[model samples]
Each structure stands twice: as structure tokens, then as C-alpha cells.
Target: MNHPSGLSAAAVQVYRLRVTHPTDSVTELGCRAGLPPEVVVAAESELTRLGLLRTSPAGGWVAVGPETATEELVAATEHEILQLQVALGATRAKMQALSAHYMEARSLRSARGDIETVRGLDNIRAVIDDLARTATTTVDTLAPGGGQGEQALSAALPNDLRVLSRGCQLRILFQDSARRHKPTGQYVTRITAAGAQARCLSHLPTRMILYGDDCAVLPIDHERTGLGVIVVRDASVLGFLRWLYDHHWSQATDFFVDEHESPLGLSSVEAEILSQLASGRTNPTISAELGMSERTVARIVAGLMERLGAGSRFEAGVRAVQLGWVS
Candidate 1:
């Protein structure tokens, strides 16, 4: 039978035998319980661990009352739960104070028309649509993560086309990892076919959407994009952002099938993976960062090792560096 207190049947049997004969020896307990001496000893040890048994003054085993043990266990569990609730309450209080400060700062910025915060997915999309509609010269974006979700791609298509139709140049930059994502590749190809400029780099510093020269939208939280966004209209900030964009664009490679291979004949994904490996990142970490499966990462590593004529990952990394495949 299953035990709510997590006692094994042997332990329960041994415990019952001990309770009935409070001064019984291990051998006697074993005989009465129909178990070997070793099993009885094991069950006794388990019972002792759970506070169901104790050593008497005469060195014989003693049985602890189940009600007493149960009361102690419940007290300990309640104490732990109360401590956790206290910690949670403290954290909530601090968070509320910080949130209030942030709201005040945001209101001040909004009053000056320098920054506007848009919360939630729906509101952010509305702001993006409005900005895209007003864009006159350029709509440049940097997508930092590997792949855009299907829903995001679908939602952006209409806004992208609207900008392009109004004679606004649409340029997008993505991380090298996105090149291996089939949906992202197809989306880029489709947009490029419709007069959009697309490029990719080994890494992107942030996610941003710049509409014209003065207006830009950026995520409020870098690691959690769905939380909200902040639109910046300050010329000084926009200038720096534009400069950052141009810097990455100058170093970025064109988004095309033919451009997938580098001068060393390594695919962008392979090169990025090799670089990460050489920097002492494990396959799992590389897979997570690149948004690829661990199995896919292993396969790619195996292929790279064979191509580089290396026997192990360390040797592959060394050879790749020597051959300038990674720095």
C-alpha cells in the first residue's frame, strides 16, 4: 500500500513491530516482522532518519510517536512557507517603489515629446504602424535575435509594404544566425524582391526600428521584447542610433544565398559557431544563443571537425583560428 508519509512497507512493518514490543532487539524485530536482520536494520535506519525511531538510555531502539513526528514536520513546513511569503512581500514592496519612480520619469520624458512608452503587444504594433505610415525617407531596423516569430512576420508585412509603397527605403539587419532559419530567409528574400535592403552580421547589439531620421522605437526590456517599447524622438539620441546602425551596416554582409559563404568557404552559421566555440562556449550554450537545436549543433561541430581535419572540438577550434575561420 502507498504511504502518505513516504514510509516503505518494510519500514512500516518494522515500526509496528517495535511499537508493540518497545524493548525488542533487532533480531527479535526481524523474526516477528518476517524480514532478515539486515532489512530490519535498514528499515530501522530509515525510521530513525524520519524521526520515527530513537536510541534509548539502555542502547535499545525506541519508537517515536507518529503524532509527535507529524506535528514537528508540519511546523517546519509552515515555517518555511511563512519565510517565503515574507521574502515575496518584501520584493513586491521594492518593485512597487521602483515602478512608481519609473512612471514619474517616463511622464516627464513624454511631456517633452522626447520619449513615449507603448505597453503591450497590441499597443506596440499600433505605434509601429503609425510610424511606418509617417516614414518618408527611410525605415531601418535591426533584429537582434536569431529568428522572427511567424506571427510577428505576418504582422510586419503589411507595414513593411506600406512603407515601401510610399517611396520610403526599408532596410533591415539581422544576426548571422537568422540566415539558417528557413522562414526568416524566405521572408528576407520576399522583402528584398520588393525593393528592401537586407543584410546580416555576426552579432547585433540591440533590436531597434528607426523611422525617418528623427523617430526610433526600441524595446523597454532587451531580454523580454513583448513587455513594451519606448519611442525616441530626440535628435541627439537618434544621431547616435543612426551612427550605430551605419557602423554595423558597413561591416555587415549582404543578405543573399551566394553571400552565405565567407572568403574561407565557411557558411555564416558555421563561422559564428566556430567563433563561439573558440571563445570557450559549450555546444548547448551555442545552440541556445544561435537558436538552433543541440543535435544540430553537434552535427555542425562534427562536420567542422572533419573539414578542418581535427580530431576533437579543441583541435577544431585551434585549427579554425589558425586558418582565420574564427578570431
Candidate 2:
């Protein structure tokens, strides 16, 4: 009843005195309850509020029957508890309905700002593992340069395998340079055996990782050779990254140990060059990216177009996509 001093200390004294005396006045209560007159006045108000004491129009106060008061208190407490349970259930349903909207809102706000910043290789790897455990569709990765160190690959292999085991599509794009690194190749071999698909690209769009099509994590360092990473859940940004992934994926070499893609009667290098050409990279850019010279890149493009019965580069690209070589 909002008593200022808290659950009144005199409730004890009042209850004790009321139990023994049937007709107790405030004056007598003040004396027998060992309470001051002022305390007696406040305690009486509280007792009347609790229905433990009632005002008797004839004079002071009368005790409410202890059995009846206990029953009333028990009934009131049960009523409040039932009401609380219903309120809690309704709140939980409201939260469930808002969850999709919550994710959408995250995408919208994250479009303006990336939400998480992670650094240190170990911490970054921890975040990746956490994401993988809950990811729905696929785990897509781009590893530039060589392998990301033997230690890092070792740490990531278990969760990578787990994702594949759960029937999640696990696709990784590694640089051609990675083939020479024994540990990374071995890791790739193991995961591929577990139903993951890996490809090697002479060029990659970025050094990053994507969980499903909605969330992305990329290195903040220029070279992507360091530990800093930024985590993003922005829809627009993820869409563009996913597009880039498809682009590179089309041009990458399927990394089966003995299988090759030279159906155009071209060498492996020439087939790769033609794939990049179909994807719209400039000549010098291709040369620098694929470690080919200007002369070599020009010669191969000419040779490929001629062999495909195409008079121009544009014609070759169109033919390539139509043939499902660069789709």
C-alpha cells in the first residue's frame, strides 16, 4: 500500500497483538504492541489496508478473522500470478513476430553502417566459428595470395567440415598460388572429400568470407595480409559481394586433383584467360592479375576468338556465356 518505511516493521507487532486480543484500540495496541503512538497510527492504517484490522464505527479497531484473511490473501496472490503468466506469454509472442522485422531493420541500418569490428586472428576466427554454427545456406570464402597460414587453416578446418556435414554448401575460392602450399592444399583436399567444392582463381574480387547471402566479413587492411576484419550484415553490400562471388566462381578452375577444363582445345592457362575475358576484365588488368604478359594475353584472346569462330572479343564472350563456360 506504498508505506514509506517499507513492509512495516509494526506488521509483526500488530499481527502479534491482534492474534491475542479481539477488541484492541489504537491506544491499547500502542501500549501492548510495544509500538509508539505514531507507529500505532501508521500500523493501523497498513493493517486496515491488508484487511488484518478493520475500523469499528463504535470506537477503535477490530481484528479481521485470521482464517478468512489468509484465504483472501491467498486468492489475491493467485489472481495476480495468473495475470502475470498471461502477460508474459503475450510478450513472448510479440517478440517472435518482431524477429523477421528485426533482421530486416538490421539490414537497413547496417546498409549505412557495419555493426561489428573484430581484430586479432584468434578473435576473428572465433566470430567466424560462431557464424558458421548458425548459418542457414552456405559458407563462401575467398582466400587471396597463398594459404592464410598453416595455423589458421588448422583452426578453421573442423568447423568447415562440420558445415559441410550438415549439408550446407561450402564453397571456397583460393588463389592459384595456394596450390603450392602443402597444408592449405591438404585442408582443401579433406574438405572437398567431405562434399565441399573448392576452386582456384588467378584473380579474386576480394579477401573475405560470407555466411549465406546476407552477412559478410572482410579484412580492413589494404593487403588483407593482416588481422583486422569488419563484419557486415547490410543487404545491399552483401548482394554486391555475392554477385562478385558468382563472377569469380564462373572463372575459377574446379580444383579436383586430376580433372581439368580444356574442352576448347586450349591449355589450362588459355581456358582461364578466356573465362576472365568473358567476364569483362581489361587486358592489362588481366595480364597483371593472371601473371601473364601483355603480349601473351593479347595472343591468347586472339587465338581463342578465332578458334570459337568469333570475329571479335564481344562475340567470344557472348558465345562463352551461352555455352555455360562463364555463367
- Candidate number of the best TM-score: 1
Question: In candidate 1, what are the lDDT values of residues 1-327, reduced to their tens digit?
Answer: 636778888999988888878788778888898899999999999999878998889867788899997888799999999999999999999999897787587457644248878898888887788678767899999997777888889888888888888888999998777777788888888888889998888777779999777588999987688889999988888899999999999988887744457788888788888898788789987876766779988999899899999988899889989988877
lDDT of each: 0.84, 0.77
Number of backbone collisions per candidate = 0, 0
Error of 2 at 208 (Å): 1.0
Indicate the TM-score of model 1: 0.59
Candidate 2 residue 257 Cα shift, in angstroms, is: 5.4
lDDT of candidate 2 vs native? 0.77
Instruction: Note the residue pairs that clash in candidate 1.
Output: none
Top lDDT prediction, candidate number: 1
Predicted candidate 2 versus true structure: per-residue lDDT over 183-244, tens digit per residue: 88899889999999999876675688899965888988735546588888777888898989
In candidate 1, stretches whose alpha carbon ends up further than 4 angstroms from where it belongs are 1-113, 260-263, 307-315, 322-324
Candidate 1 at residue 295, lDDT? 95
